[model samples]
Target chain A: MSTDLSVPVFTNQSEEELGGKWGMVIDQDLCTGCQACVAACSMENNIPFVGETDAAYGRSIQWIRIERFWQGSFPEVKMTPYQPMMCQQCHNAPCEPVCPVFASVHSASEDINLQVYNRCVGTRYCANNCPYQVRVFNWRDYADARVRPELVTLQNQLNPDVTVRRRGVMEKCTFCIQRIRHTEDVAKSEGREIRDGEVVPACAQACPADAIIFGRIDDPNSRVSQAGLASRGYHQLEELNLLPRVTYLKGESNNGSNG
Target chain B: MIKKFFDALNQPLGRVGLLIAALVVLSGAVWGIAQAQKPPEQPIQFPHKLHVGLGIQCLYCHPGALRGPSPGLPTESKCWGCHQQLQRFADPTTPWPTELQKLRDYVQQGKPIQWIPVAQVPDFVHFVHRPHIAAGLNCETCHGDVSKMTVYENPQVINMGWCLNCHRAKTEDNSQNNPTNDPAVSAMLAEKRTKLTDCSTCHY
Candidate 1:
């Protein structure tokens, strides 16, 4: 309520320890980039179908997507690395600032960026500020009963844990916060901490190659923290020192020439 | 005259006046009716005071509350479970109470008692009962002193602001590890504070 407009950067250790830092380690060597994670993320998160023309206009809303890059252009084709890119969940998330309505803020407890759909005034400042470009803006009334009648019938299929965002609100991957809270509540009721691999995000669970590893990085024994220490472990835009929680191991070798 | 009417709207004070008038009408008619001004009509005059006075636990009838999202209205069969015993214990000369007889008739006809929900958050809100109960919040915290009420009255204005206020209060108490709460529970309670304010925590 105070006039103080400071946005928390999710650095305070005590807060983070209580809620814990949620980090992901993607083993590029194990990832085949089958796009299963992408598909699963879309379904679980209720990502929109912008259609061909809208997508061509660069309006596709994919929280987690398979980004493919062809390395070489010759007869001796080089390795094509398939990376699963989503919200980096940076500890020093740049997108937290520049929100006029304070919609985009750091979850001090969880150490992840959260965008409150109801609070968002749709200035798209968060989207512009995001270095990862993962934030999606709803330009029109798409998810409502007015535009998509089939969605009205399929409304029951929508995850009860996630709210179907209305128009003019910005939204993105929350690391399936609903799932995290659910597990956290359940674990607390049972009087125990959430076990590793017990609470998996939609994308991580659907990964056939087991490339995506999500766990509490605070725990030294957790898969994410352990895999993050791998020799090839690196982060996107590492020079910027955004301190992205997603650690990616370098993928090398094995090119199946489909040509 | 028509031009003067439009000119009046152009002035800031005039606009403010119109807004005030609109708000008064809106608050008087819509907001007044929607909230606590008038208690909702119930299908049955089930008195909480009588049951609570007789030493019946709130959890006994609201068993689902301890386990799940909803504290459902007691089913007719559940009522019958106790009422049958109560009838057997009553003196043979004394006739059954009218309400009890009505309940018996309903059970015999296989009709359920349609007790209107006293506390209801919107469909979008996933207000599960167990977590609050687990966090040591009794039914009275939100529902008020239901044990004293004949008809369930929503004493607290159940709104987002009301929810946030309580959450902030708890957060302040737990954030620094208050001596009152259990050390382990204090940490969990503090952690829960962050989630409580999160829009997705309830809205989702």
Candidate 2:
């Protein structure tokens, strides 16, 4: 038997990590659509609110929205709720190729489809390219006098790291990039690897059902990757071939159980 | 001849008038740029030097800084924690700062301070100071040097790319830089090839 004295060390760096495949696995069985995640995400990322008029017209600037659809009618009616919709962070993102500016681009480091707000000139080419209708346009200044009166007061309380967007621009989800960065920074500073339950977003942290699972796609043992592999897990609008990073599990039938 | 007559007709006076108009436009542009760059001032003169430099943690007055969306404004009772005694020595007649006096007046009359916030993050972004603190980031990372400042000053420009860059750098898997050694990344990675690119992570 040949004895090897030197121990091999695995570094976080790898060539395969350059092109990211970021995706999410949401357990429909666990989802209640309580809107806590929606509120939490909005507060964390600084999403502007549309008053009664805009909300009535479906013009709200929600980076992630809960999409509810009715499958059947009357006697067999089923109203299923799908939540946390934003850019899918697609692999062959249609939004990416069309942008006049490089505002919408896929990140090489991770599978994240990034929307660089400062680079955006509000041409809204990315919005037209998206198949999921995840992109939102800001029609009016959220700071207008009629909107949330407490909004200005609320602004000062924001996480100083994130930007507060102005009106007349297109903005969407960056997957809590601030939190992800903060967690990664913490992990890096300690000279250790990023572990589970440490990089939770506001919505995931606030989620009562633990419906949302977040992690690196490369780790085979990660909860998100396993959930992605589940039999019921599937992507939204899969036929479009946008290759969304977010995955959803089929809603469990509550039938036969005591209602 | 005729060409010279037309050239003189549109001559030095016309050029001088155009130059004067251009100067007016340029000055107006300068004023507009200056106005846009100016940060709005807050209502009260709340000094961090008087509070934090004397060994006050952020949580002491703004108790909700850890639990919820905001580091809420302190109540009159919270001010009384120190001022009940300190007031007699500093200014027995005026009591603590006028803001605290106003808070006491509100409490007596059953009202709350109509405080105007100094740091304004737009409505779309969600930021939790608690998680950062829990993750071991100092309160000073985003807040700037609070301990050294006499009064709060708007010193940072938190644009979108700024946030994305920080997030990108932090998430870059640098073993030399990680501070808290949070386990969620590996747990997220272990179950599968985990990628942090869900829209729900930041926007909803």
Give the top-scoring candidate (lDDT): 1
Give me the runs in candidate 1 sitting further than 4 Å from their true place. A1-20, A48-57, A74-79, A254-259, B4-46, B73-118, B122-126, B171-204
> What DockQ would you assign to candidate 1?
0.34
Candidate 1 residue-wise lDDT, A56-102, digit = tens? 88888889877776667788666556777888887767887688787
Q: On residues A1-259, what C-alpha lDDT tens digit does candidate 2 reach at each position?
A: 2566675464554323433444567776678878888888878877767778888998887776677666667889876655556677777688887888877776654567777665677888888878878888877767544555756776665655566666667777777778776676567557688886577877778789888887777777778888888777777788765566777776446321111
**Candidate 1 per-residue lDDT over residues B100-186, each given as its tens digit:** 878878899999888878687764567888988987998888888888899898887678899888788877655354766677777
Which residue pairs collide, candidate 1?
A: none
Alpha-carbon lDDT of model 2? 0.67
Give each model a TM-score. Answer: 0.77, 0.57
lDDT score, candidate 2, position B165: 64
- Give model 2's docking category: incorrect
TM-score (chain A only) for the predictions, listed in order: 0.88, 0.84
Worst 10 residues of 1 chain A by lDDT: A250-259
